[model samples]
Target: MTASAALTVIQASTLTLDDTQPRVEAVLVGGGRVLARGSREEVAALAPRARVLDHRDLILTPGLAEAHIHLVAYGFSLSQLNLHGARSVTEVQAKVAQRALQTPPGTWIRGGGFLLSELGLGGYPSAALLDEVSPHHPVLLYSRDLHLSWANSLALRLAGITEATADPQGGKIVHPLGTLLEGASELVTRVMPVPGEAEYLAAAQAGADDLAARGYVSAHTMAFEAPEAPRALQTLAARGELPLRIWACLPHERLAHARELGLALNPGGLFQWGGVKFFADGALGSRTAWLHAPGFADGSGTGMPLDPPDLIRERGAEALRLGLTPVTHAIGDRANHEVLNAYDALRPLAAERGVRLRIEHAQHLDPKDLPRFQGLTVSVQPIHLQADGAMIRELLPHLAKTSYAFRSLKAAGAILAFGSDAPVAPPEYRATFAAALTRRDDEGQPLAPGEALTEEEILWAHTRGPALAAGWADEGIIRPGARAAFTLWDRIGGHAQALVL
Candidate 1:
C-alpha cells in the first residue's frame, strides 16, 4: 500500500483495552491514528476502500510500553561479552578469555549480567578471579544488577583503585580490591573509554530497533547512563530513525544543567524529556540494597544507600518545581521506605506542579509502607523476579512476603507501571508475563503466589501504566484519537509483533 493510503483496516481477535469498547473484531487506522474499531463489517463500512489485513485468529492489544530501561546501555550490552548465565568462575573466565583472544591485548573488556550467587560465590569476587582469564586486557564486568562491578587488576590500576584507595561517598570498594559497589563503580567507569557521539547514536538506534522488533511501541529510559545516551536517542528521533517512542529521564546530577537550559517536561513526539532519575540505593544482587533493621540474613550489612534521603528531598522538590517527575530507584526495603518518605513530603508540591512522583523497582517493601505509594506511580520490573527470587528468600527473608508486591501495591491505590530493566534483564514481554502472572521463581516455586496478576492486569501495567507514568495521553490505548501502534499476539502473552498503521 502507498504511504498516503486513506485507511488501513486490521482484523483480529482484538483487545482494545478501551473500557468503552473492550473488544473489537477490526480496527480502521489513518493519519497514524485509529479511526474506528468495531465488528469486521462495521469497521470495513467506515473505510470502504481501506487496505484490509486480516488475522482473525491472532490477538491484538495496545502497543506495549517498557516503563524502565537503559536504552543505550542495552544496545551496548548487545555487543558486549554476555555473562548472563555463567554458572561458575571458570565459565566466566572462559568467556572473558575467548573475548580476549579476539580483541587487542590492551583494550578494555566490558560485559555483565552475572549474579554472584549464581556464580557460586560466597562473597564478593576479587579482581584476581577475572585476572586469571584476561591478564592483558583491562576487564570490567558488571554484576547482573549493574550495581557491582568485578574489575581486573589492570582496570583497577588504570582507575587508580588500590587496597588503600578510599571508597567514594555512596559506594564501596569491597575489601582486598577488585569489586566496586554502588557509586564506587564510577571510579573505573570514569576512567573507561567513552563512546563517541556517532557510537552513541548507533547504540541508541540499535536499542530502539531491538525493542520495537520485540513488540514495544514505547519505552521510558531510566537515566543511568551517560548524557550522550539520550542525546543519541534524540538525534535519531529528530531524523525519524528511531523505531520506538522514547520517554527519557535526565540524571538528577544534571538537574542544574537542565534547569539552567530551561528544560521542563515535554510530553509528545517520538522522544521526550519526562523526568529526572535518582537512585535511592543499590540493588539486591549486589548486597547493596538498603534494607530496614535486621538486614540481610547473610549479614552483608544493611545494603548501601546510594542517594541520601536529604538529596532526594531537596533535589526532588527542584525537579517537581521544574515540572519533571522525580523518578527514584528504590529496590531495597529501606530504600523504598526512605523514598516514600521523601515523596510523602513532596506530594503536595508534586500535585501543585501537576507532576507524578515515581518510584522505580519498588522491589521490596515493608507492609506498612505499601499504602504510602497511594496516588504515586510504582514502576517495577517483574522480569527481575526471575533472577532475584532465590536471593530475596535468602537475604531479605523478612520482607520476602512484600517483595515485588504487585497486587498489594495496586490494591493500596498505587499505579502499576511494568518494565524490564534491560541489560539487567532482557526486555522480553513473555518473561514479564510469566513472572507477573505465575509469581514463580527460577525453580518453578512461587515466591508470593498471592501477588499473581491476571493476564488483563499485566497487559494494563505494560501498556497503560507506562503511558500514565510518561504523561502520554495518546499512547498505550486503542481509540479514535490514539496512536495506531499495536501488538498482535498469537495468544495473550505469546509470540507478538508490533504493527504501526
Candidate 2:
C-alpha cells in the first residue's frame, strides 16, 4: 500500500501551483501529506474514498505565512485597549483614564501603539504624564514601536524602579522623565503578575484563531513572551485544536534551558523551535534606531545600539552549535550593518549546520551595506510603512529611497519575507499586500514609489518567502509531499477565508 494512498482528495477547477504556477486538477492528501497532484481524473483514480473538497472556480495556492511576529504578546495585546492611532498625549491619557475606571484598581493596566512623532511631542512621554490619568492603578503604555515603554509612577513604585536605579546593559532610563527603554522595560515587567496557564492558553488560541481568520496558515513567532506561549500552542496541537502551524523561537537567554531540556531543532508538529531571536538595536519610531554617519533628521543623536555585535556573534555561534537558527532585529542602517558584519563572521558556521540566519526589519540599509543582505532573508513589515513613511521623509530623507526598500532588497537577491510585527504593527495581511503593492501611506503620501513591489511579488513574499525563511520546506506550497494546508478567498486580493480541507 502506498503511504499517501489512504488519505483524502481535494479537487479544484484550477489546482494552482504544483511544481509550477496554477494548473487544473486534484490533490490527494492523506496523513496530512499531498500524496499526488494531477488532472482530476488522475488523482480521483487513486483515492476514490478521499472526500472531495471543491473550490471549482477559486484559486488554490499555498497557505500564507507570517515570517515574523510575537505570538503571546499579540494575543495579550488583543485584550488590552489599543492606542495605536491616538493623535496626542491627552488622547492617550483619556483612553487610559477610561480603561482605568473599567478595570479594577491596581490591575496593572497595559496598552500600546502611541507614536512619539505623531503626538506632536518633541520628547518621549514621562511617568508624570501617565500618572495624571492612572495615578491609582499601575499603567504601562508602550510606544508605537514597542521599543520604549512609558510607566505611571504607581507602576514604577511597584517595580521599585527609582531614579537612582541603574540602567540595564543595552537599555536606558530616560533621565528625570522616568521612561524605560529596551531592556529596562523588563524591570517593570518582572514585577507584573505572571499570567496563569489559563490565560496563556486562551491568548494562544485567540491569537492563532485571529491569524487564521486573516488567511494565515502559519507564522514564525519571534520570542518575547513567557515560555508558556509555546507550551500553550503545544497543548492546542495535542488536542487537535491548533488552527495554524507555528514556528516558535527562543531568546538567546533561554538557550541554556533549552539545551538542559534536551531540545534540538525538531521541525515537525504544529509548533517547532526554529531559531534564537536577538535584538541588535532599538526601533525607529522610538528614536532608538542605531544609524551611521548622519543621525535622525531631527537634532536628536543617532539611535541607541541594543545588543553589541560581538555579543551577537559569540552567542550566535553557541545557538548554531545546538542546531538553532539565529534571528536578529536590525532596524536602522547602522543596526543592519552591524548584524550583517556579525552574520558574515558566522556564515561559515551557519552554512555548515544548514541553518539560515535571518535579520528582522532590515528596514533601513546603508547604501554601502545594501549588498550584504544578498541571499539573506529580510523579514519586513509592509504595514509599518504606513506609519513610518512620514518619519522616513523627515528623519532620514537621504536614505528614504532605501527605507523599507522591498524591491531593492529583493533585486539584490535577498529573500523578502513580509509580516506585521504585530503589536508593533498589527497582523493585517491584506493591508500589507496593499501597502507593499501601492507604496502609499495613510496620508496617501508616496514614500518611495519606486520601491513598490508587484502584486505577484507581494503574494510570494507573504507566502513562499516566509515559509523558506522558517526553513519549512513542506509548507507554503501546493505539491506532492507538501503539507495539505491552503487558504480560500472570495477573490485573490479580496476577502480571505480559511479553507481547512
Q: Estimate, for each residue in 154-270, the C-alpha lDDT of model 1 and write its tens digit.
A: 999999987889889878898888899888899999998889998998889889999999999999999889888998998999999988988899899999988999998777789
Please identify model 2 stretches exceeding 4 Å from their true place.
1-7, 13-21, 45-49
* TM-score of each model, in listed order: 0.98, 0.95
Over 4 Å off, model 1: 1-5
State which candidate has the highest TM-score: 1
Q: What is the lDDT of candidate 1?
A: 0.90
Model 1 scores worst on lDDT over the 10 consecutive residues at: 1-10
lDDT of 2 by residue, 105-222 (tens): 8798999988887788888778898888888999888887888899989998998888888888878888775588888899899999999999999998998999998888998899
lDDT of each: 0.90, 0.84
Write down the RMSD of all candidates, one decimal each: 1.8, 2.1
